[model samples]
Target: MAIASVATEYVFSDFLLKDAKEPKYKGVRLELALDKIVTILAVGLPLFLISLAFAQEVSVGTQITCFTPFNFSMKQAVYVDSFCWAAVQYQADNSPLWLHKFFPYILLLIAILMSVPAALWRFTGVPYLSSDLNFIMEELDRFYNHAIKLAKNLATLDDRDAEQDSQSALDLAEGCFKYPLVEQYLKTKGFSCGLVVKYMVCQCLTLLVLLLSCVYLCYYIFLASLVDEFPCDVRTGMLKNDSAIPAAVQCKMVAVGVFRLLSYINLGVYLLLTPLVVLAALGPARQSSSFLQAYEMLPGFGALSKFKPIYNDLSIYLLFLKENLSELKSFKCLQVLELLQQSAEEGFDTMCVLQTLSQVKTDVFDSQKMGSITNICEMDKPKN
Candidate 1:
């Protein structure tokens, strides 16, 4: 009985603690900090190493093999480098002078290759995250607005009409649920979500591309860093019978060290960039006001005009129409239309189109009228 009481107390305490824990509601501090730190190090160390390697490559050149004595042919010089390099085991013991000749440039190539992906990931990945952030922020604003609207309705309700008001509010809520504030916002914003979607897809593609690049770099780095100084057999093709040609040429490519550093840096940056991108994508998905923010640009277009997938289509069409009108002969009819239409469209800014239309001569109507219009404005086109 004593044990049971103690166990029950412990169970109750655990339940209470769990119930007390509030969900992180917004900007929710949801990232796994451990994974973040690990990613940082994993990404940073390689980049740091790559940078260091590059610095070394930049500071000290990679190739150092000397041409054999002047009397010897190019083949002989090749032979000298080949014979000496093939023997890194021998050079380690002997410390020959040729190894020092060609070291820097080889390392530079390595550095460049390694750093390429790292820089690319950053350049492409962060924009994706930013778009997602905007989406989240927009949704939050809309949610806040909806909440305000609900509170307002609740405050002004009449006791007798409570059921009716409740039903109306419920219907509005139901509609909003089917088509979120974020969705409405997206329409008002003019199909910008399409852009966001495109950006996401592009980011994913870039992620995979950068990852593949990193893998390729890793393979090359692994092999290159192993023994940068290697012997090349130049005995193929036409050089078979050449006694002057050494069996192998000692070519120490100095670029590998720099390349390795670049690769490490590249990997780290991409790893960081990619995850942030994923976060960005997910953030927009969960953002509270994403739909609302997109729509807020237009004040009251929701009831009659639906948001289209391509928001700017009408605007683009209007501009094109304006351009077409500008080429015409007169604007007598256009000025009147502009005077009438400008207040309504909040769009199809007819100023240029009207101005262009106005330039067209009304000479076809009457001589006296043409003369008056000519006085009001110059008609550069041929008057019919």
Candidate 2:
């Protein structure tokens, strides 16, 4: 176990080295089961027990059911209870109390509060997991597409999984890449360095959240988890004037047992999530090394060699006239036009986007994305 933790840290530290280097091409992704049941179990059990403690308090109902002077009426009994209680200034033994009291509830409340950040993070943060997988999946699909396009001009498929799954998931994810904002988000400048960084950051956030939460829970747990046993000054307030009262009183909190149980559960979950938080920061590059490498190679190669960019600019100005020129389709024609236009004219400025577009290539169109893009593009189309 210790070795595994060390290994996890080692893997993360290794990432720091790569942060400064060019990313490699090894596209992997993380897929974990999302059973809200497990999440509920992790967070819910403690709260449920806290509730159960409340229920017990309701059923029993008194802090210390002392036999005050029988002469006292119910209200007077409460006062005597309150007075000595006030004098003792405490409760939690002899009978029941939490019926109206709020301390343990507050402690339980704290435990529940501690669970909130992690709970929200798990549910909200991880739902994105499926989407994230879709992201890599789309990226992989596009890589295949570009490979296929380039492959047509080149020889065999370089990547193993490419040629096969080509029609499989891509078929299902067809057009899934149309408006790949998430993928774009993954790659700031067509590089997913930000994705890894964001991932690491989010992990740190998770760790900090959990760590802070654990601190809260630990304190509450320490307070609540205590055997609920303590001593208090029995003769304070008015009782201070009374010599009959014991100088000091023994005080044992009633719900510590329940709070202890709650704390144990909270502590356990926090401990478990702590490492996952660490992994989140470290695992991105390893997970999507393939995609990163693909994205990284783009800027280096995405630029205009010379003529194409120049010709492309002239083509844009004579956009109407250029429509007839199918010559652009052949790379050889561009050189003949030899920088006829400025470098900006003939080049592929759209390469980065087109490339990223190519990376997320899908066989089919994302019905929804297709419609939206069509609607938007139709709106953006030049007025003829």
Question: Best-fitting candidate, measured by TM-score?
Answer: 2
The C-alpha stretches of model 1 lying farther than 4 A from their native spots are 1-58, 64-193, 234-240, 290-384
Error of 1 at 335 (Å): 44
Instruction: Give TM-scores for every candidate, taking all chains together and pairing residue i with residue i.
Output: 0.35, 0.40
Task: List ranges where model 2 is wrong by over 4 Å.
Answer: 1-43, 63-77, 80-198, 212-251, 289-384
* Candidate 2 C-alpha lDDT tens digits along 31-95: 22222223344456557766776786676675544454445468855655455444332343533
What would you estimate as the lDDT of candidate 1? 0.43
Alpha-carbon deviation at 69 in model 2, angstroms? 6.7
> Which is the leading candidate under lDDT?
1
lDDT of 1 by residue, 321-381 (tens): 2223322211223233333343333334322222222333333444454344334333322
Q: With candidate 2 superimposed using the best TM-score fit, by how many Å does residue 306's alpha carbon deviate from the native?
A: 27
